[model samples]
Target: MLDWIFLFLTISLCLASRLLLSKLSNTSKKKQTLPPGPRYIPILSSILFLRRSLFDFEPILRSLHAKFGPVLTLRITSRPSIFIADRDLAHQALVQAGATFADRLTATEASRLLTSNRHNISSAPYGPLWRLLRRNLTAEILHPSRIKLFAPARRWVLDILVNNLKSKSETGDGVVVVMESFQYAMFCLLVFMCFGERLDEKTIRDIEAVQRHLLSSFVKFNVFAFLPKITKLVFRERWNSLLAIRQKQEEIFIPLIRARRDRKQQPGNGDGKNNSNRIFVYSYVDSLLGLQHPEDGGRKLSEGEIVSLCSEFLSGGTDTTATALQWILANLVKHQEIQAKLREEIEGVVGSEGEEIKEEDLQKMPYLKAVIMEGLRRHPPGHFVLPHTVREDVTLNGYLIPRGAAINFTVAEMGWDGKVWEQPMEFKPERFLAGGSGEGVDITGSREIKMMPFGVGRRICPGLGLAMLHLEYFVANLVREFEWKAVDGEAVDLSEKLEFTVVMKNPLRTRLVSRRKD
Candidate 1:
């Protein structure tokens, strides 16, 4: 009923807009030097878009790329989405001319609501605020030194994971669904980092439920992006649902925020919460608590904005790492020889099967690191990075990128380029070792972008180092604890699914046989 009403109200407006655009498009066609793409049919484009899922259009886009060239355009909606698959062009725009293309796409109504109208780091325009937030995250929370403080949290989460998997595999046919465990483990680690305290299982799981709901339902609310004035009225229920999710987040997050704020003031919390007088451990929230919003009269972050920031911190840390971990593990299960090789390396480096794998220990095993890198190269968590908006009109490889045009890099395509990798489709950890083409490659893409799983340039994820540590630590330990085996009649499927991240279409279900003698 609401849908019909909004469509009814917008139909005439859309037709009028289409007629106006058809005239403008024709005039601009002669003047525009934009990349080759399907001609926009205005109203027909909108109707066709309404019939398909947003991310489902990738196949069509790939075909379009093949027909047109490395750089092509698609007027997926009224806005043209420019995609870059060629490495040199990516380097030129995102690296050589990064400042010119550093701006993010204009946020939708839903995005603005969630990001507090660009309050957080990722969505904020390229400016002082983005710099501040990114710096704080990198220096205060994600710095290598700061990450060492969370070693205990990772260990605790690891114990919980190993125990959970062992118990899970013991049931029935002994095949365990691992994504749930992987995601939960990440939530455990990140929540501790965010809150500065160890929360109970119930609180951790509760937070996970709300945060995951917000991420999964994000696309559903993109409808609220269009005609939000009318859609907000028509889609009141959806709007309400979105608000409820946020409200739930605040209800949980604020108390945690307050507790951290309270902890800072509490003399004993600095020493930790016991008669033993534990030294106070600072947290991500603690850093935010001290920050004054650069734009808001230097006012401290509002409770709502803190909630938004915390949500961003938690979401980024959780889903992307968890998705990557599952993919790496799934690949290990499918390729037992690779698994055996990595296991041998782990045992050799760590000395004893019983000795825990430390970060320094990880540094000693290049092959273990190579396996994690290959997994990222093979299955980037996000196929295309968050769309980038150009700061001004610019030409790349003779194609015009108008000011404010949204650009995206085809991340998976770059990783799979046969020209870049001798055989890109095959899982090959050896590619990262000495004498291979991928040897000594830099992920930051400062010199040239070969493959970017966590993206690159000014807007590259600040959490890159921390994420790599988490992957290597977790993957190394998981492989150390269990000899992963494929379930008969249930092959390890590598097919992709479009989620908040590009996840395994079939979440990895594998048999875990204990390597440790009890």
Candidate 2:
């Protein structure tokens, strides 16, 4: 009888303990709720996402932010896209608690096609591979000390741009439309940096055409990101078109790649292939030739992978900088007083004629830096950064951000925040000057994320330093060389249209008056 009683007691205790553990698990689950967003009816929501391309998706998100709040979700794919428009929350997730939110989402079919299964720095996951690729670019190529080495190359491209504009100004009523020239000029410079060769005009243009085509077609390929198995079949022609573009890219780039590889493998330690142009001191391709994939059994990068990386390097450095140059010049043209003031500042620093404004002089001209900063603030080339993902479930502003979900920050909105800027819409360079609101703003978001034209955190654009130098170098030279004036009939439109980067809806058509007279 006593033995039976003890057995009953043990069974009772086991049941009570199990009940207690189950109740605790249920309570923990109740605390995690997704950020409020549009009700996802699956098919309809996906259709809406497909219809609204990256270029036009802002308007939809703006309305959602109003109803749900700054931190919200949009389930456009199997995964949710959470956009953070608030600066504090963005800082909280991207900086303060960075490790939990540092990973990138799995590359979609469209991205994988371009990046060679996520090998490039921009698309690679946040791990050993991403670290290796990013470090290679930053330390090997884009380091601040290394940028000065490209001074001659910058001058070469500047001459090409100036001459191109001059020839146009000499004819056709002298209203030189500048966007195409800006892009081509950037391509020529970057090509030399990437390939270790100063390719001829025809070759540079050929590469430019292919890259521009890919960038413009980016929006059209978004459908391939969702239900790609079915979408590839449904949008068969589009898929084939993308494939054809990639093939043409390989054809153009592979020979250049092979030539570099062959030259490096030549007799006498590559000395036989010494370049006459001083611009060949180091090339981006040379670094790539020596890189080994960390996770892929230490194998050298394949030809296709090299081409994809080269494509990223070329496209990234070319378009964004070129687009930014146009806007800075456009604003200079639109506001003549600001242009004259800028010219005066350049004069103060660059005292001699026939002598170029070297990168060194860029420091003395405070107003010149201000103009570039204001241009970026007023019109960041990309309104939103490349999407970021979380490594683990995280909370921002009392909302749960699930692991692996993509997060996008509102770049343009942050720059234009009324609380941040006095006259948010105005093209005012003064804002960045001393006593101005933007004075000493930290763009890297390492301290605070005032504006992230390049993005922030561990994955912040590795090319940030290079991009700035290019902008300052080009803008300073272009202004010092020419007096940009508005065309008589057409206005310098600030209205934006999304291309690979957001560009002026109506491209800048300006009349150039040469500031330098021989």
| Top-scoring candidate (lDDT) | 1
Task: For model 2, give the 10-residue run with minimal summed lDDT.
Answer: 271-280
Across 1-518, the per-residue lDDT of candidate 2 in tens digits comes to 45324433443455457558767775664678889998765555555666676658888878888899999998776578899999888888788877777788888798898889998988988899889888888887898777777888899989999899899999968889899999989989899989878888788889988988898888778877765676676778889999999999999999999988877665554443344423235788888999998998999999999999999999889889999999999999999999999888888887636368888888888898899899988889999988888877777898888888889999988888898899899999998999999999898988877888888788787877888888998888888888899998777789999888999999999999988785
Best by TM-score: 1
Report residue 380 deviation for candidate 2 (angstroms). Answer: 0.4
Report every candidate's CA lDDT. 0.87, 0.84
lDDT score for candidate 1 against the true structure: 0.87
Residue pairs with colliding backbones in model 2 are none
The C-alpha stretches of model 2 lying farther than 4 A from their native spots are 1-30, 267-280, 352-354
Q: In model 1, what lDDT does residue 335 have?
A: 96
